[model samples]
Target: MTINETLIEKKFSNDLTEAELLEFKKLYETDDAFKQEVDFLKNVQRVSETEDDALFRNQLATYETEISPKKVFLNSKWIKPFSAIAAIFIITISISLFMNKDINNDSLFSSYFEPSKNVSAPIVRSEKDEHLTNRAFIAYSEADYQQATSLFQKAFEQTGNSELLLYEGNALLAMDKVTEAIEVFKTHLTYSDALTNRTHWYLALAYVKSDQLDKAKQELTIYIDSEEKFKKTEAKSLLKKLK
Candidate 1:
């Protein structure tokens, strides 16, 4: 399938032969525009999921209230208008309360809302790019996958850095978009300066998701040969899993 179609179908998680994986890596390296588009698509998915969750919660609340026997009495003609008026009043009060709460809660929430005062901010930070990367890392380390995805996407746009690409790939994987995640990991492999063993390890995991045993084994083999001690151990463990 064409790269665009593959991305749309989320087929990047599919098991690919070593040759296929390598071929895609080459394409990703050569096609800058494609990489940008894929990043954009991933970001869109992240935002859409957040919105969907909020909508689902609202729908669920509506369903629960509507289906209850208590709601039937409110539907009666005598009570309906009063109920409607009361509802409007309640909504108005809620909005006013929320606005005021922000002011009132300032002192109460101050400690919680305070930026990390003990942790010094980075000197020579790269503005939006660095900020997003830092946010993504914090979210990832905390296992906050959704926030990491959003921040990493912003990081990728601001810097197009390999580290952000790797984090973005990881975030996608955490969201179970194995194919898309594989594509992202493979894209990082195109960078001559990418951390070789780490890239290989992630790519191998992606291969495992697609059930491409041979390709996974091959990547693990390369990863194990790298100078990085920790990654070599990881590679060996992964190899055992493939076996």
Candidate 2:
């Protein structure tokens, strides 16, 4: 099956191999045709599920006001029938909520995306061989992402140091190369045990940039639950936005 066709199934099933995942990243970053295909499929799926987004939201608001907050006295005879009716009402509204196209996770991505904080800025690099690393950090701090991305990658290749990898990912992000940043973090997390919570924060932001709502949600879940979560407050706030 074509990647686009597989993407539709994967969206629901949440079962993408690493290579297919990379294809999504590539398409999202580089391919206008593929991007449109994904968007069209998303809209089609949403439209298939919901006729009107505003109406869907309104109905849910109504149901929430009527159903969830009340103390239902189920033991009383009149209340029992009312409860049964309410249950049916809830099931119907729940279906509507899921199917609505306008009820999307991407609406808040822009509002929630601030640059993930620089946690490694305080360290001093002081080696002759580490001149590129120092320059990369300087360029990164100055927001010269083009230079930083190149320098950081060079340092990473020379040393296999996780710090360079992390900073390179950050540079990729500053350059708006988010999918590449995500891949860098994915590899770093898999291979290096050094960068932890902060790396996850960057990964989640990369997912947010890619508009991969579910993937972002997963990483945010890790952040929210982690005691050492570098972006705990941000993750909590972003989760609220996503939901």
Candidate 3:
């Protein structure tokens, strides 16, 4: 298969090798046709898994019957097989419908809001692990966001470690406390820590979750313009959607 078809298949299966992931990112960034095709496929996959799958399947059958025998070209580099033409036609229609609909901030936030891992304080399982910071991160790793948020606040207050605020913000965001997470991320930004860029990215997601489109756009722009590489591509995509 061509890079376009190979990457698209691997993407849906969550099985992209590191090199394939790099190729996917490059194509997604540089090739508009490839990017749109991947996005349309994403919509197709999403709709197929929803409660209206039966209805969507019936519609797909109708679309298939109506599609011409002409081959569907995904990009200059990739022409879909004849058997896949009907599926490609349905994907194109789905993309058109999605484009014509209003931007769903909630859906966008859900799609992109993955909490960063606990990099500030890596937890090791040990009987001697008695430190408050260790317990805080341990709680975080266990998905106990409530306790983790509380311990993070205390740890930051006790140690004056601003990075704890970043984790705290993440815990809050994971718990769906957007306003609290935004404040914690802002507080983290006030410090001259290396995590300043990361905090801003989280703050952007918090703004998006709260439907503060203006703030979300501003924060996303900052992340996209920054030297930080984390989520820069996703930030650009989200910013484009907001626009």
Backbone collision count in every prediction?
2, 0, 0
Q: lDDT (CA) for every model shown?
A: 0.59, 0.67, 0.79
- Specify the poorest-scoring 10-residue window by lDDT in model 3: 74-83
- How large is the C-alpha RMSD of every model relative to the true structure? 30.1, 22.1, 18.5
Which is superior by lDDT, 1 or 3?
3
Q: Pick the candidate with the highest lDDT.
A: 3
lDDT of 3 by residue, 1-243 (tens): 576887887777677999999999999999999999988766655544433334544554555456843533233112222224455576889998765442576688889988788767668788887788999999899999999999988888899998899889999999989899999899888897878898878898888888788998999888888899988888999899889
Which candidate model has the greater lDDT, 2 or 3? Answer: 3
Lowest-scoring 10 consecutive residues by lDDT in candidate 1?
111-120
Deviation in Å, model 2, residue 188 alpha carbon: 1.5
Order the numbered candidates by TM-score, best leading. Answer: 3, 2, 1
TM-score of 2: 0.51
lDDT of 3 at 235: 91
lDDT per residue as tens, model 2, 1-243: 565657645643567788878877787779888777667655544444423344544454565558765642222222323334444567888888864533353445455555544465553545553576677777787888898889878877886677667777877876778888898888777664446556777788778777787888898888778776465787888877767
61-177 per-residue lDDT for model 1 (tens digits)? 565477774543222222323333344566789999877755443322222211111121232334455466677777776777788778878877887776666766777766767
